[model samples]
Target: MELKLYRAGWALALPAVRMLLARRGRGAGMRFLEERLGRDWQARAPGALWFHCASVGEVMTACPLVRRLHARGAAPLLVTTNTPTGARTATRVLPGAVGHAYLPVDTRRRVARFLDRFRPRALLVCETEIWPELYGACHRRGIPVVLFNARLTERTLRAPAWLARLYAQALAPVRGVLARSEGDAERFRALGAHRVQVVGNLKWAGCPADPAGPPPSAVPYWAAVSTHEDEELRLARIERMLPSDAPVLALVPRHPERGPAIAARLRAAGFGVAVRSRGEPPAERIWLVDTLGEALRFMAHAELVFMGGSLVPAGGHNLLEPARLGRAVVVGPHMEDFAQETEDLVEAGAVVQVDDEGEAGRTIARLLADAAARRALGQAAAAFVAARGETVLEAYLAELHAARLPLDRAPA
Candidate 1:
């Protein structure tokens, strides 16, 4: 009864979804609508491997796997993402993908049409994208639906009963679930995902090869990455507390549009600031990285890194990125979304956790003053990430082969 109501409600919401997409702008939004409505779009190839990454973060996590699949001759892979940024990253990073597009709204008919058109041999849903209609449609067609790098937070597990039941039902058709941690695997099982396996996180697979040419900036700096609203002001305060001779501070907000506002705020607060998008780095004390896909680049050159999102309630961005880069890392108290990984890193002494803005300032100052401590932290972080190895990706490939999925190395 509840499932029927959900289907009805989703069907009724399709028109509103179309209007929202149209309002977002024409480029990818219009293209997405046209494809969903069964006009002006075609799949690059039938029986392709399909991967869905919801946004930029997921795109990063999916890139390595996509590259491995392609190298093994899984040609004509189809990638779909809900955000334009994700789509762009997918296209840029996974050049082997036959196509990249916004995922269609999850109405029954639209999902069925997508399945019929693409005819993917298997569908890989990246990190917490549970679309009931799409899963059901693929299941009916006998296509394997695997959840890759899956994670479930405590809040999600303890959601209101009705929503929890809906999620459980939505996850029912997944053939396999590769969780990021054992705790996440348990949550998926509690939410009705059968065959859950603890495959660890693929983000630990390691950082991308260095970009060709010189580093983005040669000056030594401290990086504040993926910061959320008001976190910049807090970071500014922390900067003021650092030693007078400490390296420059690079402020990289999670959203590029916020760069101007952040720069203005820092300047208004009487700090010397330079925006990266405007061109060359300044000799100012603060350099605002007003761009995309360059956070890792900045982290690579930093004396230390303080990941954002944790200062506020944004569940924190990936702490592993900086750790993988072998940079001394600092985060705040609210890393609940990355609970398992955060705890493990903290236990290994690879990351420093502060309880508040004041503590963050003190911690940064202490690390900056003691170069030896920074080196120790960085070395520990790199080693901790390296210890995870490639077990996760290997497990995923083994499962895919065992299921008799089509692949270059699989028997014809």
Candidate 2:
């Protein structure tokens, strides 16, 4: 069945290959594949496992696993990610591993070419990325494919029946699934995933920020992480509503490109300001850490954090990042993407959900007024994450092994 699927997918190669001549910025993903993988790409790696993470979050989750594999003598494991940001994070964090482009859009030929070249013993896929043709091609070549930290949302559950059926068929090629939570496992089963198991969120094991780093001044500040335009604007208003004696604000925009624009908006709003990444940390002004790779560090420095993506309908960003750092968390109403985790935190007094910026500001003011209450909330958040531990890793590694091909050689 998988072979036939791959055969049908082979037809997509014409368009995929043509991607090379298309506009560089547009269809660049496909173009990248065509340009990078030349003829005879089926050459196998000497001794390596392949881990595919779609973006920055998944890259962070896969870091510990990659290190564990290295400790177990799996050197030179190949890492692949679709986004430029993911690639940068992987390269920066996964030290000593070979990094490569992800197999291009599910065209059989592209997948085949990729497998032939990387010839990894096994393929570990993070989260919900399932490419039928890619998995089918791997199956055809006797390579194992596994889905790790898999998750299926309520929206995914309520998909049109036909679409769900199609998705089930698409997922049929993978050998096993390591779901991030019990809810995730149940959803996968409802959607026809086999060999599914519940693994706690890998975010629990996310690397901690260096405590030795210079301490941010002991000012009463709240962090707004991974925020978008709408959220940022709303937060600026919230900041304004705070009492003049309130601590400075740490606003980390999700995209670095928007830093200047955000800074301008904040300044125009009549708030004294400093941009952290621009060497402008005003001793008594708001600090906009317009940098990347340090959201968690800032969280550690914050008295409280309002997670981003919740303000608008973007399905909230990771609240666990702050929770794990022992910070009191506040979030906007929209969190369907991480419904279960967020709710759990709320129930445990680890998080507070506000309807809008007004509520967020009010909540922060309340917490700021009561230091003991804030500490208590932060403690609970930390405890919740610590309890989850490495359960996610165990389940994911188990599933990956189920589909693993024999290792060509151990790392020396």
Candidate 3:
């Protein structure tokens, strides 16, 4: 009943959704547009293990699993993501995968077209993308679906009844769930997900530091990374509250496409800014680190780092990205998305947690005054990440074996 209503709603919204997708996908190329619209694009051979990632974050998070699958399995692999950035990352990170495409718009008709194109043996989803039409179609077709690295936030679980009904219906069809935490498992169970298990965060094992790169600029620089909308401004303000000269500020917005607009705002606010996409060097006032795939490089070079998305209730990005780089990391109080990591790191004195940007500035200021103190914090973080070991992948593979999924070398 709820599925019928949901489909009806999507039917009404389909035109607008297509327009939004077209606008967002500008310059992503004709193939990108066609694949997303449920037409064109190369078809996959039957029986591939299909993975759907929502965007850049999920694609990156799934890197460890995808790489493992690519290395061990003879079965063809296909990855579909919701955005162009994700497609580009899949091309970069999971180059061995046989095919990558945008996930079709999530109406029954479009999703059915996509399924017919791929004919996947099993569907593995990353994180919290719940599409009722897609799930219902896959279930009706008897395709096995597993959600790994899954998380359900408290706010989402407690959504109003109509929305919750749709989610419950979507989850009911999932064959298994590998949750990131026990709390997440419970939340999924409450949402009617079956066969849920706490397998720990895959990201903990996925994103280790890359070999350190040359400094982003000659002067020492610090980064506020994965920042969402006004967060770039908010974290950039940390400079004003600093006691002495802060390191050159790299304001890395989460969305690279927003770089030009963000730089304009920074300039209007009386800060000299340079856009990375424009080949602008670090400006005197603020160097807007406006490119994809380089946030970690800046973090690795900096004496201090701040993970964004926390100060403005955007939950927060992965803290472990910089932590494993042995950089002193700080974050604001609204890290609900990474609650466990935030708590563990804070308790261990590995990451400094503050209530707001004001506290963040003060926290960073004190750390700047004492080089030894910064090193101690960074070392603790790196140690904590290293101590986590490599269990998530093994356990997740075990889950696959137990589920009768053939992940070993494909049948001859």
Candidate 4:
């Protein structure tokens, strides 16, 4: 009954959702709209593995997996993302042969159109995507579905009973769950998911080669990467609290598209700002890194890197992105999203976790003042990531083999 209500709710809200998509899909052209509606002119050739990554973060993290799959020459691969930004990341990062599309809205009818057209053999839903209709439709077709890099946060575990019931139903058809941690596996089990296994975090083994180059400015700077809007005001406060000429702050907003607004906000707050997407040179106060796919470059060059999404209610982003780069990384206390990664890094002194923006400011100041200490933290981060080894990909491939997935043969 709960699942039925959930679908009905989606059905009723779909009109408004279409308006919302229209707004989001502005200037994206007609194909974006077509794909989101589960009907597109792009006739998908059926011989390909399919992966659904909901957003930019998942799309970026899925690169390593996609590359591994692409290398095997098993089949053509198709990746669907919910947002245009996610689609862009898939296009930019995934190999040229891979296909990209906007995942249709999760109504049974729309999802059926998508599934029927592609006829995917197996579907790997990245992270926490639990679209009931999508899962149910795939299951009805006998498509093997796996939840990759799966996690069930405490916050999500505490969802209302109705949601829990709906999720349990959604997960029923899921064949396997590749959890990122034991705690995650336990939570999935408690939530009624079957065949859960702890396969480690795939983001831990991110891009092997960094596109990092020299720091944009000769002036020493520290970066706050993937920051949210709410946290932007806090960063403005933190910057004001710092000394007259503290290392220039490289403020990289989580959504590069928001760079203009963020830069305006920081400027109105009385800071000199330079917009990178506009080709402006680095400013004395803040360098707004508003471009996509270049976060690692700034992170690699900064004196110390502060991760965004942590200081605010927004769940933290891929904290390990910078950690793997061997940079002095710090995050705010709200790291519920990446708790295991933060915990592991904190235990090894590879990353600093603070209670609030106040502590973050102090930590940034202290680290900026003491280069040797910052370098020590960076070295520890490097060592910890090195210790994690490169087995996550192999572990996932093994899971496929155990499931009797014919990676090297035509789909049966």
lDDT of each: 0.81, 0.73, 0.82, 0.83
lDDT of 1: 0.81
Q: Against the true structure, candidate 3 has what lDDT?
A: 0.82
Write candidate 3's Cα lDDT for 1-412 as tens digits.
7777777887898789879888998988777778888876665556678889999889888887878777775468888998988888788777454678788887777899888877777888999988888888889988878899998888897787887988987888788899999999999999888889998888877643345588778877778888888887776677766654667778888888888888788777777787777788875657888787888788888888888899889889899888988899999888988999889899998999999777788888898778999999999999887676367777887887787765543334
Encode model 1's per-residue lDDT on 1-412: one tens digit a residue: 6567677887788788778767664676567667645454555667778888888778888887888888777867888888776776776677654577567777777777777777777888888988777877887888888888898877788977876787888788778888888888999999888888887888876436446335677777899999988999899888877777788789989998988788888789898888889995857878899897788788887889999999999989889888987899999998977877889899999999999999999999999888999999999999888776466667777876775666653223
TM-score of each: 0.87, 0.79, 0.86, 0.85
Model 1 TM-score, 2 decimals: 0.87
- Residues 1-412 of candidate 4 have per-residue lDDT tens digits of 8878888898899899889998999988878888898776384648558888999888876788888888888576889898888887787788888888788988878888887788877888888888888888878888888988887777778988998888888897788999988988999988889888999998876855546787677777789999998788788788778897788788888889998788788778787888888888775577788998778888888888999999998889888878877789999998877888899899998999999878988988898888899999999998787667367777888887787654663455
Question: Candidate 2 residues 24-115, lDDT tens each?
Answer: 32534443444334333322344467888987778888787776766666655777776556666776777554555544655656666666
Q: Compare candidates 1 and 2 on TM-score and give the better one.
A: 1
TM-score of 4: 0.85
Backbone clash total, candidate 1: 0
